[model samples]
Target chain A: MAESRRPLPRPTPETQHFWDGTRERELRLQRCDACSQVYFPPRPFCPACASRKVSVFAASGRGTLYSYVINHRAPPGSGFEPPYSIAVVELDEGPRMMTNIVGVPQTPEALQLDMPVEAVYEDFTDQITLPFFRPLEAS
Target chain B: MRPGSVAIVGAAETTELGRIPDQSQLQLHADAALNTLADAGLTPADVDGVATAGESPTGVAHYLGITPTWVDGTAVGGCSFMLHVRHAAAAINEGFCKTVLITHGESGRSRIGRGGFSRPAASLQGQFEAPFGTMGAPSTFTIPVLRYMKKYGVTEEQLAMVAVVQREWAARNPRASYRDPIDVDDVLSSDMIAYPFRKLMCCLVTDGGGALILTSAERARDFPQRPVYVIGTGESVETPMVSQMEDFTTSRAFRVSGRAAFEEAGIAHGDVDHLMIYDAFAHLPLYGLEDLGFVGRGEAADFVEERNTAEGGKLPLNTNGGGLSYMHSGMYGMYALQESVRQLRGTAPAQVKDARISIAHGVGGMFAASGTIVLSNEAR
Candidate 1:
């Protein structure tokens, strides 16, 4: 049996910069020039203030685990093993992003809520590099 | 809209509750719609408005041979039916259309003529969340519960108790898919699908559908069945992504929608005799109970643990076994609404005694949207 390919993010013009940063091994996020509100999952404008004067910059790459679930059932063709951690990490700059927690046991005892984590990049293809997180100490 | 100005004269689910591979998704919608119309002693010619969620209103209307003056295709997820009811009422009050028929059907389990649940690679979820190995509702919807539990001191046993009590109700309902008695241990020991969520904690993936017919309250007396007045209705949306929810512990959409419905009804929380919170997962009711103002924040787990939502309690919730034990087609809002109508009409299988007021609340996506409806046995 052939290994199923995992789904990859298809970036749009608005989100191209964030993906570009990931390829260069940097976590990028957007900040609003009007309200000074930092946001994630990159958008062209500030979600809070609706200001189009948003700027993208390399983020701190540090965050705390906000919430998560240890998924035992992987979607067919997702190329993930069972019992992986699917997590939402709240970044230091104040936005949550969904990412997998790497370099630790995927257990409730190990993945405590509010534990500090930092970003680590994995090059999936020449054009795509995914940003995952690890325990802050491990990173 | 004025309270009791609109009433549900016809409501019915497909004759068969589960596993209907023979029927296409649209056929299931037609089945439920035809059954509902028959219940009211009417036909397609009587309906001038059409509303549906899973399927386009135009398709449902044309398939049923009804020339509708008003059509609504609110595809907000499971709770789309509840919003349809609310919008249809407003449309009726404004004379946009007269008689409205709302339909819902999904071949959730069989996947018979059902659209794929895939997001476009460029879609927000595809770009931001899906690439992170999230399987489906089990992986995503169950994420916030741990945070909720940590903040509220809610134990896993209390969460399991939700499934247990709903099963107790299911035991009384012959139509429920799983009627056997289950305890907290049974739920906790069930196969783990996602961390902190077991198979029993998740809703059933069954194939079923339901429909409702709404008309002016003045003509409600002419119907064969007792009229379940649509006293109040409300709907709201929050975020598309579960990770971006305003707060992880509570659902803003549930709060906004529930409060609007209660205010419109001009009723107190104590007046509610029956309740049906969309139980896509066990944690949903916990959030619904708190967010809907039935219980204080962080109080729902304790409320369920004390059997307050069980039989012979102050409140009767999920009387039709809920989505947990009852048939949960992908879109479960219509079933929740159907159960509310049944309770208000004194026809539910696990009927609450003299249940005068029933509230049916539903959630769409992963707390992305919500719709709430307040029903009364009396027009006033």
Candidate 2:
């Protein structure tokens, strides 16, 4: 039963490195060497400029909770429970990522937008660990 | 642009619209494809390319008994079908195939193959929003509409104004399913499906099928119809994840695509005669109006209030009743383009009187991808 839970998107050639980094418990951003723009969707080249000079870089893995929604439906093969916080995290390195705000009470008031959050990796297997986020209290 | 203009010469549908019989998804697709070919005065043998949507094990090309040079089953969102027109046009322009048929069949009314594509959420989207009960298209779109209403200070009356006006337009359209004219009060009072969006604002899913036969403008001369030239098109994607979208009040994708389409067509906004924006919900037109640059930002409600967007107004829109009242075959994008073509032909049941220029706009994937097409009397 545990073996059936597969991530919805099996990363393709363009995004395999990004997913691999996720599994390795490191947040990697595809940074364009030509323009210094970090891309969330790892691509063949820089979207800002048509330059193919782009490389993956490990980010600080700290970010702010940008926005989120709580999904109730049980998607096929997705073992997540209802009422979990799915969100966009604005990374410290400036790239916004689609992720979940985990280990926090799920409510609009509790899950405030722009709340400071940091990434925590949950290793499921040797090749797959999801990067979930938690609220980082402002010091 | 090079001279390879894909003209939609034929269009047909099998809208078991009001009360669709229990036909399989494949049967609906086959019927629509055959009907479209007959309408175009051709047969399945004459077609070389087939583009389709819906969960049918039999691929469209194999079902149609012809081999296509290109097969695009990109299931991005409901509006992905409109995106296919642009893809088909480019393919036709590139001399890949001559006759391209784009089609869609869905038993949404019956929920065939329910949860067919609801696989695991990956690519960080699952990590963030998928767990939080922030689910599905209607609910995802609802939050943004709420934000639009909130940020713009749009009242419920103004939001309902879209439905009142749409009902009016739908009344004239024989193809429209819901003919009962609704007022602002009716829209406001209707059962709230999601906050800010009432049952009236949401599109009624109907079991329907739509088919389009696209051929070069040069090939259009031989057909028994006026050639609606594919002038200019632009499609853009913002984010597949709803939570990642930058703004809820407006669509960034539409803004991007609108500029590109306007530039490609070399036409000004004021020059547009007919507008066919996807009205999956009332707020869609609101978002579309703002991002399409028709009205000032956050003023789409006022734009509708001023009666600038209704039929017989300065800007006549959704002449074939739109998806709100018309049969929505899951993907409303193809329907929008088909209606635009019908308007240009002066043959639509709800024709926009001599529509020389028509804009076919589609909003898809929780406002992720927007595609715009500017079809004129001829390529200017």
Q: Indicate which candidate wins on DockQ.
A: 1
**Candidate 1 lDDT for residue A61:** 93
For model 2, the superposed segments whose C-alpha errors exceed 4 Å read: A1-139, B1-4, B18-21, B55-58, B113-115, B121-123
Candidate 2 lDDT by residue in tens digits, B1-380: 33226688888787455446577667677777887888899988888777765643247777778777776675667777677777888888888889988887777777653335463555444544443344566656655554566567888799788878877888887778988888888888887554556778778788778788888887888998777887878889897766657776677899998888888777888888999899888778888878888888888888888888776688888777777887676678877887888888888886676678899999887887888888876643
Error of 2 at A29 (Å): 11
Candidate 1 chain B, poorest ten consecutive residues by summed lDDT: B127-136
Query: In every candidate, what fraction of the native interface contacts is reproduced?
Result: 0.84, 0.18
TM-score (chain B only), all candidates: 0.99, 0.94
Clashing pairs in 1: none
Which docking class does model 2 fall in?
incorrect
Model 2 chain B scores worst on lDDT over the 10 consecutive residues at B125-134
- What docking grade does candidate 1 earn? high
* Model 1 misplacement above 4 A: A1-4
| B276-339 per-residue lDDT for model 1 (tens digits) | 9999999999999999999998999999999999999998899899999998998899999999
What tens digits encode model 2's per-residue C-alpha lDDT throughout A76-138?
555666556556677888777767677777666687766789888776656556677888873
Candidate 2's clash total is 20
